[model samples]
Target: MSGISSASGILAARSALLAAAKAALDGQTDIDFYSGWQYPVTQPNWVATTDVHADMDPANIGPRRSQDETITLGVSIGAWLPGHTEDDIVAAFERAFSILNTIQTHIRTEDITLADTVLWCVPGATDSDGAVDEDGSGYQVEIATTFVCQHRVRAA
Candidate 1:
Protein backbone atom coordinates (compact mmCIF):
# COMPACT_ATOMS: atom_id res chain seq x y z
CA MET A 1 0.00 0.00 0.00
CA SER A 2 1.19 3.54 -0.82
CA GLY A 3 0.24 5.70 2.12
CA ILE A 4 0.60 9.09 0.50
CA SER A 5 -1.49 12.22 0.83
CA SER A 6 -1.08 15.97 0.44
CA ALA A 7 -2.61 18.98 2.26
CA SER A 8 -2.69 22.75 1.62
CA GLY A 9 -3.58 25.96 3.47
CA ILE A 10 -4.03 29.71 2.85
CA LEU A 11 -3.60 31.62 6.10
CA ALA A 12 -6.53 34.04 6.20
CA ALA A 13 -4.32 37.04 6.76
CA ARG A 14 -6.25 39.11 4.25
CA SER A 15 -9.63 37.63 3.51
CA ALA A 16 -10.75 40.84 1.86
CA LEU A 17 -8.53 40.27 -1.22
CA LEU A 18 -11.65 40.21 -3.38
CA ALA A 19 -12.85 43.65 -2.36
CA ALA A 20 -9.33 45.04 -2.53
CA ALA A 21 -8.88 43.96 -6.15
CA LYS A 22 -12.18 45.56 -7.14
CA ALA A 23 -11.15 48.80 -5.52
CA ALA A 24 -7.68 48.76 -7.04
CA LEU A 25 -8.94 48.36 -10.60
CA ASP A 26 -11.26 51.28 -10.03
CA GLY A 27 -8.24 53.54 -9.90
CA GLN A 28 -5.86 55.32 -12.28
CA THR A 29 -2.21 54.35 -12.55
CA ASP A 30 0.51 53.40 -15.04
CA ILE A 31 -0.35 49.75 -14.61
CA ASP A 32 -4.03 50.50 -15.17
CA PHE A 33 -3.52 52.42 -18.38
CA TYR A 34 -4.47 49.43 -20.54
CA SER A 35 -7.73 47.51 -21.31
CA GLY A 36 -9.19 50.71 -22.81
CA TRP A 37 -12.03 50.80 -20.28
CA GLN A 38 -13.31 53.50 -17.97
CA TYR A 39 -12.56 53.38 -14.26
CA PRO A 40 -15.96 52.47 -12.84
CA VAL A 41 -14.89 49.22 -11.17
CA THR A 42 -17.64 47.15 -12.70
CA GLN A 43 -18.12 43.42 -12.10
CA PRO A 44 -17.90 42.26 -8.49
CA ASN A 45 -16.94 38.69 -9.34
CA TRP A 46 -13.35 39.64 -10.11
CA VAL A 47 -12.09 38.19 -6.86
CA ALA A 48 -11.73 34.69 -5.59
CA THR A 49 -14.36 33.45 -3.15
CA THR A 50 -12.88 29.99 -2.60
CA ASP A 51 -9.38 28.93 -1.40
CA VAL A 52 -7.58 26.38 0.74
CA HIS A 53 -4.64 26.47 3.19
CA ALA A 54 -3.12 23.03 2.92
CA ASP A 55 -0.68 21.19 5.25
CA MET A 56 0.68 17.77 4.46
CA ASP A 57 2.06 15.38 7.09
CA PRO A 58 5.05 13.16 6.37
CA ALA A 59 4.02 9.55 6.29
CA ASN A 60 7.14 8.63 8.22
CA ILE A 61 8.75 8.84 11.67
CA GLY A 62 12.23 10.40 11.40
CA PRO A 63 13.04 13.87 12.75
CA ARG A 64 10.31 16.36 11.80
CA ARG A 65 8.80 18.20 8.84
CA SER A 66 7.14 21.58 8.61
CA GLN A 67 3.80 21.94 6.84
CA ASP A 68 3.50 23.98 3.62
CA GLU A 69 0.75 26.47 2.73
CA THR A 70 -0.15 29.17 0.22
CA ILE A 71 -2.78 31.86 -0.32
CA THR A 72 -4.68 31.16 -3.56
CA LEU A 73 -5.93 34.60 -4.47
CA GLY A 74 -8.40 34.60 -7.36
CA VAL A 75 -9.66 37.51 -9.50
CA SER A 76 -12.28 37.90 -12.23
CA ILE A 77 -13.27 40.76 -14.59
CA GLY A 78 -16.66 41.27 -16.23
CA ALA A 79 -17.96 43.89 -18.62
CA TRP A 80 -21.46 45.09 -19.47
CA LEU A 81 -20.26 47.52 -22.09
CA PRO A 82 -21.88 46.62 -25.38
CA GLY A 83 -19.83 46.40 -28.60
CA HIS A 84 -16.98 45.08 -26.45
CA THR A 85 -15.12 41.89 -27.34
CA GLU A 86 -13.69 39.18 -25.08
CA ASP A 87 -10.16 40.41 -25.81
CA ASP A 88 -11.10 43.78 -24.36
CA ILE A 89 -12.06 42.34 -20.97
CA VAL A 90 -8.91 40.19 -20.77
CA ALA A 91 -6.67 43.11 -21.64
CA ALA A 92 -8.30 45.14 -18.88
CA PHE A 93 -7.68 42.38 -16.36
CA GLU A 94 -4.03 42.14 -17.40
CA ARG A 95 -3.70 45.85 -16.84
CA ALA A 96 -5.37 45.58 -13.44
CA PHE A 97 -3.24 42.60 -12.38
CA SER A 98 -0.03 44.44 -13.16
CA ILE A 99 -1.15 47.37 -11.06
CA LEU A 100 -2.14 45.02 -8.29
CA ASN A 101 1.37 43.51 -8.07
CA THR A 102 2.86 46.98 -7.89
CA ILE A 103 0.78 48.11 -4.88
CA GLN A 104 0.40 44.78 -3.13
CA THR A 105 3.14 45.83 -0.69
CA HIS A 106 0.49 47.47 1.54
CA ILE A 107 -1.49 44.30 2.12
CA ARG A 108 -0.62 42.18 5.17
CA THR A 109 0.85 38.71 4.94
CA GLU A 110 2.19 35.97 7.22
CA ASP A 111 4.67 34.50 4.77
CA ILE A 112 7.43 36.74 3.45
CA THR A 113 7.64 34.94 0.07
CA LEU A 114 4.62 35.17 -2.21
CA ALA A 115 3.72 34.55 -5.86
CA ASP A 116 1.14 36.33 -8.03
CA THR A 117 -0.75 35.06 -11.08
CA VAL A 118 -4.11 35.32 -12.84
CA LEU A 119 -6.15 32.22 -13.72
CA TRP A 120 -7.79 32.07 -17.14
CA CYS A 121 -11.48 31.33 -17.55
CA VAL A 122 -13.51 29.74 -20.33
CA PRO A 123 -14.81 32.02 -23.08
CA GLY A 124 -18.60 32.30 -22.81
CA ALA A 125 -21.54 34.36 -21.55
CA THR A 126 -23.76 34.05 -18.52
CA ASP A 127 -27.42 34.74 -17.73
CA SER A 128 -28.46 38.28 -18.56
CA ASP A 129 -28.71 40.56 -15.59
CA GLY A 130 -29.70 44.00 -16.94
CA ALA A 131 -28.51 46.24 -19.71
CA VAL A 132 -26.22 48.92 -18.37
CA ASP A 133 -25.09 50.54 -21.63
CA GLU A 134 -26.58 50.77 -25.11
CA ASP A 135 -27.24 47.76 -27.38
CA GLY A 136 -29.79 46.62 -24.78
CA SER A 137 -27.30 43.99 -23.61
CA GLY A 138 -28.32 42.45 -20.33
CA TYR A 139 -25.54 39.88 -19.83
CA GLN A 140 -21.89 40.63 -19.21
CA VAL A 141 -19.03 39.07 -21.15
CA GLU A 142 -17.05 38.35 -18.01
CA ILE A 143 -13.30 38.10 -18.55
CA ALA A 144 -13.12 36.27 -15.25
CA THR A 145 -9.66 35.33 -13.93
CA THR A 146 -8.01 34.17 -10.71
CA PHE A 147 -4.68 34.60 -8.90
CA VAL A 148 -2.77 32.21 -6.64
CA CYS A 149 -0.49 34.03 -4.17
CA GLN A 150 1.89 31.69 -2.40
CA HIS A 151 3.37 32.73 0.94
CA ARG A 152 5.01 31.54 4.18
CA VAL A 153 5.39 34.05 7.02
CA ARG A 154 3.74 35.51 10.16
CA ALA A 155 0.66 37.71 10.37
CA ALA A 156 0.89 41.27 11.67
Candidate 2:
Protein backbone atom coordinates (compact mmCIF):
# COMPACT_ATOMS: atom_id res chain seq x y z
CA MET A 1 0.00 0.00 0.00
CA SER A 2 1.27 3.46 -0.85
CA GLY A 3 0.90 6.43 1.46
CA ILE A 4 -1.28 9.33 0.48
CA SER A 5 0.21 12.73 -0.31
CA SER A 6 -0.21 15.82 1.87
CA ALA A 7 -2.44 17.48 -0.73
CA SER A 8 -4.73 14.47 -0.82
CA GLY A 9 -5.02 14.48 2.96
CA ILE A 10 -5.99 18.15 3.03
CA LEU A 11 -8.58 17.70 0.31
CA ALA A 12 -10.10 14.77 2.14
CA ALA A 13 -10.44 16.80 5.30
CA ARG A 14 -12.10 19.68 3.43
CA SER A 15 -14.53 17.35 1.65
CA ALA A 16 -15.64 15.83 4.94
CA LEU A 17 -16.21 19.24 6.47
CA LEU A 18 -18.31 20.43 3.54
CA ALA A 19 -20.52 17.36 3.72
CA ALA A 20 -21.13 17.78 7.43
CA ALA A 21 -21.91 21.47 7.13
CA LYS A 22 -24.35 20.94 4.28
CA ALA A 23 -26.27 18.36 6.24
CA ALA A 24 -26.34 20.54 9.35
CA LEU A 25 -27.68 23.53 7.52
CA ASP A 26 -30.26 21.66 5.54
CA GLY A 27 -33.36 23.68 4.59
CA GLN A 28 -31.63 26.96 5.36
CA THR A 29 -31.86 29.06 2.24
CA ASP A 30 -30.16 32.09 3.71
CA ILE A 31 -26.87 30.30 4.34
CA ASP A 32 -23.96 30.24 1.88
CA PHE A 33 -20.49 28.71 1.81
CA TYR A 34 -17.29 30.26 0.46
CA SER A 35 -13.68 29.23 -0.03
CA GLY A 36 -12.30 32.26 1.77
CA TRP A 37 -13.24 35.65 3.20
CA GLN A 38 -14.75 37.05 0.01
CA TYR A 39 -17.49 39.10 1.54
CA PRO A 40 -19.99 40.22 -1.05
CA VAL A 41 -21.11 43.81 -1.45
CA THR A 42 -24.72 42.68 -1.23
CA GLN A 43 -24.02 40.10 1.45
CA PRO A 44 -26.51 37.51 2.50
CA ASN A 45 -27.98 37.31 5.96
CA TRP A 46 -25.67 34.44 6.85
CA VAL A 47 -22.39 33.14 5.47
CA ALA A 48 -20.06 30.25 6.29
CA THR A 49 -16.50 30.17 5.01
CA THR A 50 -13.97 27.32 5.04
CA ASP A 51 -10.17 27.57 5.14
CA VAL A 52 -7.83 24.54 5.23
CA HIS A 53 -4.18 24.31 6.31
CA ALA A 54 -1.85 21.30 6.70
CA ASP A 55 1.00 20.79 9.13
CA MET A 56 4.35 19.91 7.55
CA ASP A 57 5.38 17.47 10.27
CA PRO A 58 4.35 13.85 9.79
CA ALA A 59 4.25 11.08 12.41
CA ASN A 60 5.48 7.61 11.57
CA ILE A 61 3.96 4.49 13.06
CA GLY A 62 4.63 0.74 13.17
CA PRO A 63 7.42 -1.12 11.42
CA ARG A 64 6.12 -0.12 8.01
CA ARG A 65 6.44 3.55 9.01
CA SER A 66 2.87 4.45 8.13
CA GLN A 67 2.49 8.24 8.16
CA ASP A 68 -0.11 10.32 9.94
CA GLU A 69 -0.74 13.85 8.71
CA THR A 70 -2.60 16.64 10.49
CA ILE A 71 -4.88 19.11 8.77
CA THR A 72 -6.44 22.10 10.48
CA LEU A 73 -9.61 23.68 9.10
CA GLY A 74 -11.14 26.94 10.19
CA VAL A 75 -14.88 27.62 9.75
CA SER A 76 -16.30 31.06 10.17
CA ILE A 77 -20.01 31.87 10.32
CA GLY A 78 -21.15 35.46 10.00
CA ALA A 79 -24.49 37.20 10.47
CA TRP A 80 -25.36 40.65 9.19
CA LEU A 81 -27.92 43.12 10.43
CA PRO A 82 -29.36 46.14 8.69
CA GLY A 83 -29.16 48.42 11.66
CA HIS A 84 -26.81 48.97 14.58
CA THR A 85 -29.43 49.28 17.25
CA GLU A 86 -28.92 47.35 20.47
CA ASP A 87 -31.74 44.96 19.57
CA ASP A 88 -30.37 44.36 16.08
CA ILE A 89 -26.88 43.66 17.37
CA VAL A 90 -28.20 41.22 19.95
CA ALA A 91 -30.22 39.39 17.33
CA ALA A 92 -27.23 39.11 15.03
CA PHE A 93 -25.12 37.67 17.81
CA GLU A 94 -27.79 35.14 18.63
CA ARG A 95 -28.02 34.03 15.03
CA ALA A 96 -24.26 33.63 14.72
CA PHE A 97 -24.02 31.67 17.95
CA SER A 98 -26.85 29.40 16.91
CA ILE A 99 -25.18 28.61 13.62
CA LEU A 100 -21.88 27.87 15.31
CA ASN A 101 -23.53 25.56 17.84
CA THR A 102 -25.32 23.63 15.12
CA ILE A 103 -22.08 23.20 13.18
CA GLN A 104 -20.18 21.86 16.20
CA THR A 105 -22.94 19.46 17.11
CA HIS A 106 -23.26 18.10 13.60
CA ILE A 107 -19.50 17.60 13.28
CA ARG A 108 -19.30 15.76 16.60
CA THR A 109 -22.20 13.45 15.84
CA GLU A 110 -21.48 12.72 12.20
CA ASP A 111 -18.97 10.16 10.96
CA ILE A 112 -16.60 11.76 8.42
CA THR A 113 -15.18 9.44 5.79
CA LEU A 114 -12.72 9.83 2.94
CA ALA A 115 -12.05 7.32 0.19
CA ASP A 116 -8.73 5.41 0.32
CA THR A 117 -7.80 7.14 3.55
CA VAL A 118 -8.23 6.59 7.29
CA LEU A 119 -9.58 9.80 8.81
CA TRP A 120 -10.21 11.09 12.30
CA CYS A 121 -11.77 14.48 13.06
CA VAL A 122 -11.47 16.26 16.38
CA PRO A 123 -13.13 19.63 16.93
CA GLY A 124 -11.12 22.37 18.65
CA ALA A 125 -11.87 25.71 20.28
CA THR A 126 -14.61 28.23 19.30
CA ASP A 127 -15.02 31.99 19.62
CA SER A 128 -17.54 34.73 18.79
CA ASP A 129 -17.63 38.52 18.52
CA GLY A 130 -19.83 41.39 17.32
CA ALA A 131 -19.04 44.74 15.75
CA VAL A 132 -20.88 47.75 14.40
CA ASP A 133 -20.01 50.10 11.60
CA GLU A 134 -18.65 53.52 12.50
CA ASP A 135 -21.71 55.16 11.01
CA GLY A 136 -23.96 52.83 13.06
CA SER A 137 -25.72 51.79 9.89
CA GLY A 138 -24.83 48.11 9.97
CA TYR A 139 -23.83 45.46 12.47
CA GLN A 140 -22.17 42.10 12.12
CA VAL A 141 -21.57 39.04 14.27
CA GLU A 142 -19.01 36.32 13.66
CA ILE A 143 -18.35 32.93 15.20
CA ALA A 144 -15.45 30.65 14.35
CA THR A 145 -14.38 27.07 15.07
CA THR A 146 -11.33 24.93 14.30
CA PHE A 147 -11.27 21.26 13.43
CA VAL A 148 -8.15 19.09 13.58
CA CYS A 149 -8.11 16.11 11.26
CA GLN A 150 -5.63 13.25 11.45
CA HIS A 151 -5.25 11.17 8.32
CA ARG A 152 -3.38 7.88 8.42
CA VAL A 153 -1.53 7.04 5.25
CA ARG A 154 -1.41 3.51 3.95
CA ALA A 155 1.90 1.68 4.22
CA ALA A 156 3.65 0.10 1.31
Candidate 3:
Protein backbone atom coordinates (compact mmCIF):
# COMPACT_ATOMS: atom_id res chain seq x y z
CA MET A 1 0.00 0.00 0.00
CA SER A 2 1.07 3.57 -0.69
CA GLY A 3 0.69 6.54 1.64
CA ILE A 4 -0.18 10.08 0.65
CA SER A 5 1.96 12.76 2.25
CA SER A 6 0.61 16.02 3.60
CA ALA A 7 2.40 18.01 0.93
CA SER A 8 0.81 15.99 -1.85
CA GLY A 9 -2.62 16.28 -0.29
CA ILE A 10 -2.34 20.05 -0.06
CA LEU A 11 -1.22 20.37 -3.65
CA ALA A 12 -4.00 18.14 -4.86
CA ALA A 13 -6.59 20.06 -2.92
CA ARG A 14 -5.40 23.34 -4.35
CA SER A 15 -5.41 22.00 -7.87
CA ALA A 16 -8.88 20.58 -7.51
CA LEU A 17 -10.23 23.89 -6.24
CA LEU A 18 -8.65 25.88 -9.04
CA ALA A 19 -10.03 23.56 -11.66
CA ALA A 20 -13.48 23.45 -10.16
CA ALA A 21 -13.70 27.21 -9.75
CA LYS A 22 -12.54 27.89 -13.25
CA ALA A 23 -14.93 25.41 -14.74
CA ALA A 24 -17.92 26.58 -12.76
CA LEU A 25 -17.27 30.33 -13.09
CA ASP A 26 -16.56 30.42 -16.82
CA GLY A 27 -12.82 30.94 -16.34
CA GLN A 28 -13.18 34.64 -15.60
CA THR A 29 -11.71 34.54 -12.10
CA ASP A 30 -8.13 34.31 -10.88
CA ILE A 31 -7.01 31.73 -8.29
CA ASP A 32 -3.68 31.40 -6.51
CA PHE A 33 -1.92 30.48 -3.27
CA TYR A 34 0.32 32.68 -1.06
CA SER A 35 -0.04 35.58 -3.50
CA GLY A 36 1.27 39.05 -2.75
CA TRP A 37 -1.51 41.01 -4.45
CA GLN A 38 -3.63 43.33 -2.33
CA TYR A 39 -7.27 42.46 -1.66
CA PRO A 40 -10.36 44.37 -2.87
CA VAL A 41 -8.30 46.04 -5.60
CA THR A 42 -7.73 42.60 -7.01
CA GLN A 43 -11.37 41.94 -7.66
CA PRO A 44 -12.84 38.64 -8.84
CA ASN A 45 -9.97 36.63 -7.39
CA TRP A 46 -9.52 33.78 -4.94
CA VAL A 47 -6.59 32.80 -2.74
CA ALA A 48 -6.18 29.23 -1.54
CA THR A 49 -4.38 28.17 1.61
CA THR A 50 -4.13 25.12 3.88
CA ASP A 51 -4.59 25.24 7.64
CA VAL A 52 -1.48 23.60 9.07
CA HIS A 53 -2.87 22.59 12.44
CA ALA A 54 -6.56 21.92 11.73
CA ASP A 55 -5.95 19.27 9.09
CA MET A 56 -3.34 16.94 10.45
CA ASP A 57 -3.46 14.00 12.85
CA PRO A 58 -0.62 12.42 14.84
CA ALA A 59 0.98 9.48 13.15
CA ASN A 60 0.08 5.98 14.30
CA ILE A 61 2.92 3.57 15.04
CA GLY A 62 1.99 -0.04 14.32
CA PRO A 63 1.59 -2.58 11.56
CA ARG A 64 -0.39 -1.05 8.68
CA ARG A 65 0.12 2.39 10.13
CA SER A 66 -2.63 4.80 9.12
CA GLN A 67 -3.67 8.31 10.05
CA ASP A 68 -6.97 10.14 9.73
CA GLU A 69 -6.42 13.56 8.20
CA THR A 70 -8.67 16.49 7.60
CA ILE A 71 -7.42 18.94 5.00
CA THR A 72 -8.90 22.38 5.51
CA LEU A 73 -8.91 24.37 2.29
CA GLY A 74 -9.57 28.08 2.40
CA VAL A 75 -10.74 30.16 -0.55
CA SER A 76 -10.87 33.93 -0.10
CA ILE A 77 -12.83 36.06 -2.58
CA GLY A 78 -12.40 39.80 -3.10
CA ALA A 79 -14.26 42.49 -5.03
CA TRP A 80 -14.04 46.28 -5.22
CA LEU A 81 -15.62 49.45 -6.51
CA PRO A 82 -13.92 52.82 -6.96
CA GLY A 83 -16.34 54.83 -4.86
CA HIS A 84 -16.48 55.78 -1.20
CA THR A 85 -20.23 56.03 -0.87
CA GLU A 86 -22.13 53.64 1.37
CA ASP A 87 -24.06 52.28 -1.60
CA ASP A 88 -20.82 51.53 -3.43
CA ILE A 89 -19.46 49.59 -0.47
CA VAL A 90 -22.66 47.63 -0.19
CA ALA A 91 -22.54 46.82 -3.87
CA ALA A 92 -19.01 45.60 -3.54
CA PHE A 93 -19.96 43.38 -0.65
CA GLU A 94 -22.83 41.91 -2.63
CA ARG A 95 -20.61 41.22 -5.59
CA ALA A 96 -18.00 39.50 -3.46
CA PHE A 97 -20.63 37.42 -1.70
CA SER A 98 -22.12 36.30 -4.98
CA ILE A 99 -18.79 35.00 -6.16
CA LEU A 100 -18.18 33.30 -2.85
CA ASN A 101 -21.48 31.49 -3.02
CA THR A 102 -20.87 30.34 -6.55
CA ILE A 103 -17.55 28.83 -5.58
CA GLN A 104 -18.96 27.14 -2.51
CA THR A 105 -21.88 25.59 -4.39
CA HIS A 106 -19.60 24.22 -7.06
CA ILE A 107 -17.33 22.52 -4.56
CA ARG A 108 -20.22 20.99 -2.71
CA THR A 109 -21.82 19.41 -5.77
CA GLU A 110 -18.93 18.63 -8.06
CA ASP A 111 -16.88 15.48 -7.99
CA ILE A 112 -13.22 16.24 -7.17
CA THR A 113 -10.67 13.58 -7.93
CA LEU A 114 -6.94 13.66 -7.28
CA ALA A 115 -5.11 11.94 -10.07
CA ASP A 116 -1.93 11.11 -8.15
CA THR A 117 -3.38 9.61 -4.98
CA VAL A 118 -6.43 7.92 -3.53
CA LEU A 119 -8.16 10.54 -1.41
CA TRP A 120 -11.66 11.64 -0.55
CA CYS A 121 -12.79 15.30 -0.45
CA VAL A 122 -16.02 16.73 0.89
CA PRO A 123 -17.33 20.22 1.53
CA GLY A 124 -16.92 21.57 5.06
CA ALA A 125 -17.88 24.65 7.00
CA THR A 126 -17.41 28.19 5.70
CA ASP A 127 -16.06 31.01 7.82
CA SER A 128 -15.00 34.69 7.66
CA ASP A 129 -18.18 35.99 6.11
CA GLY A 130 -18.38 39.01 3.84
CA ALA A 131 -17.54 42.39 5.34
CA VAL A 132 -16.98 45.75 3.76
CA ASP A 133 -13.58 47.18 4.46
CA GLU A 134 -13.31 50.28 6.63
CA ASP A 135 -10.68 51.68 4.29
CA GLY A 136 -13.38 51.93 1.59
CA SER A 137 -11.30 50.01 -0.92
CA GLY A 138 -14.05 47.38 -1.32
CA TYR A 139 -15.17 44.17 0.31
CA GLN A 140 -13.79 40.70 0.99
CA VAL A 141 -15.36 37.30 1.68
CA GLU A 142 -13.76 33.97 2.58
CA ILE A 143 -15.08 30.39 2.50
CA ALA A 144 -13.42 27.24 3.73
CA THR A 145 -14.02 23.50 3.10
CA THR A 146 -12.53 20.54 4.91
CA PHE A 147 -11.34 17.53 2.93
CA VAL A 148 -10.89 14.26 4.80
CA CYS A 149 -8.07 12.24 3.27
CA GLN A 150 -7.15 8.83 4.59
CA HIS A 151 -3.45 8.00 4.42
CA ARG A 152 -1.78 4.70 5.12
CA VAL A 153 1.95 4.50 5.66
CA ARG A 154 3.80 2.11 3.38
CA ALA A 155 6.01 -0.48 5.03
CA ALA A 156 9.71 0.25 4.90
lDDT: which candidate is best?
2
Q: In model 2, state the lDDT of residue 102.
A: 77
Model 2 lDDT per residue over 1-156, tens place: 122643447765676676677777888877776656665634444545467777645445546665677778888888877798889989898888877777777766765442333366767777878899667788988777787777765444
Q: What digit string (tens of lDDT, one per residue) describes model 3 on residues 55-140?
A: 44566544555455555555555555566466876776676667666766765666444333335555566555555557866554
Worst 10 residues of 3 by lDDT: 32-41
Model 3 pairs in collision = none
Candidates ranked by TM-score, best first? 2, 3, 1
TM-score, per-candidate, Cα-based? 0.37, 0.78, 0.60
Better of 1 and 2 by TM-score: 2
Q: What digit string (tens of lDDT, one per residue) describes model 1 on residues 1-156?
A: 011113233433234344444454456432222222345554432333333333323443223343333344433344333333566455444444454453353333322222221111111221222223445443334333334444332222
Q: Which stretches of candidate 3 lie over 4 Å from their true place?
A: 1-8, 27-54, 58-62, 112-119, 122-156
In model 1, the Cα lDDT at residue 118 comes to: 14
Q: Candidate 2, 40: how far from true, in Å?
A: 0.6
Residue 2 displacement (Å), model 3? 12
The backbone clash count of each candidate, in order, is: 18, 0, 0
